[model samples]
Target: MVRERSSHWNQKCRCLLLGLTVILILGAVVVFAAVILAGRRDPPAELPQWKGRGSTANLEEIILGRCFIYTRIVNPELRKDCLKIWETFKNAFVSKNPCNITEQDYQPLMELAAHPIQCNKTLLWSKTNELAHKYTKVQGNLLTLEDTLLGYMADGLTWCGSPSSSETNYQSCPHWRECANNPVSIYWKMASKTFAEAVCGVVHVMLNGSINHAFGNSSIFGSVEVHHLNPKKVHLMKIWVMHNIGEQPSDSCSGSSIKELKSIIEGKNITFSCEDDHRAVQLIQCVGQPEEPACRVCRTEF
Candidate 1:
């Protein structure tokens, strides 16, 4: 009887210990779940419209101040017409969906700011905005689209209109791909067409040689500008395939895209010539690396 009672007591103790162990494990699990839940955080709220949006004053400064000063210097008659320009610009895109604005919407503003393109001084570029701008500035004779009045006014500014209101949406604007007829892309297309139509004598074209395709068909220079070049007006097209100073370039005047450009120019019956490592482009590259051996011999190409 004593041995049986001892055995029964042992069994009771084992059951109690098992129950305690189960209870402890459940408690640990609850604590772990609570810690995980406590560590999580809520996402931040979207900012209020007033806090996120930009002001019209910034646009006014860009147009009335920088654009006005440049316009006045170029043509003094426009000195007092800065406000008029601003008004015209606002009317072009205001009260309309930004993505819905087309190139024709800017026609009124373009008409107001239009100037005759100088002969033989037109510079067409693709993927060479910085170098081309620098080259034009240094030469002081060649004119890119940016040198024109309309281009100067809206070079890098972004403004959009609303359907419910007549105010500008400075907070967010449609990207270029968001719509086919967006304001910015269409404006450049129109400008490029105008610029190309004015090409005369020996026209200069700047292209980047480091990219996969130096003369992409979709580029403004290729699609719009090149298409507008009148064989009768433009006698010769000089293509400058620019490359980095030290690095060996992937594409050249003989590259497939460039050959395609040549074929296109030839199809128009305009004379075509190309230069690899064009001296002018190298000189622009040399501006930052004047100590380089290649830059030491850089000369102006007329």
Candidate 2:
């Protein structure tokens, strides 16, 4: 009886040991699985270079707000779909390689944001941003790039997106000359083309007389804007070369590039006229610098 009782005790202890071992194994497995799941749920600690580092919310707000304000004031007829416009604009570059973005990427946004351009008032400018805007703002009859909806939203803003993320890089962006088709340059080029195609009747181009290559063939006005103008729709291209209030203009109708530009326009069977030291520009200068000898006299001719 004693021997049988001892054997029973030994058997019970063995069973207990086995059960404890199984429980320990199961618990370990559960812990390992939980650790793995927790790791998977966590976000990456480091981001890749291609991933954009900034948010475009501010830019979007600017664009949307401007759209509402400008559309209401400038052209109430344009139905303002701010959200849809933002989505289309963002989708063009967001989660895509910044350098890989092409002019066609912006097509949807361009089509969605189409607004009418008044005929005979479209003004194209090269190296003359401030002057051109001042002229347009005061004149009221003329409209430059910034006067347009798209141009107004994108003016002086730099942004880009990455292929792995849907955020715009507000901190740093590709320089304009970094590549032939950088995001900003591509957008403007496409916008310029759209603006140019809408031209009808007389079109004025403001070229800076102080700069060399005033009519640069590679400029947005030269390459994109000049190319899309249809002779049938556009009757004349008035070249308004602005100079210092009382200085000899560096470029004129006889200048090589200007002459080439004239030839290009005439080749398309459109009449071309160039005026050096435009009177209106000189008068604008006089308003700002009324004390200067040049401003005091305010002569279109030097």
Candidate that scores best on TM-score: 2
In angstroms, the error of model 1 at 99 is 1.3
Tens-digit lDDT string for candidate 1 (87-152): 887887777766677777887777776667767898889998999999999889988888877777
How far in Å is the alpha carbon of 258 misplaced in model 2? Answer: 0.8
Model 1: pairs clashing at backbone N, Cα or C within 3 Å = none
Error of 1 at 45 (Å): 18
What TM-score does prediction 1 earn? 0.75
Q: On a 0 to 1 TM-score scale, where does candidate 2 land against the true structure?
A: 0.84
* Clash statistics: count for each candidate: 0, 0
The residue pairs in collision within model 2 are none
Candidates' TM-scores? 0.75, 0.84
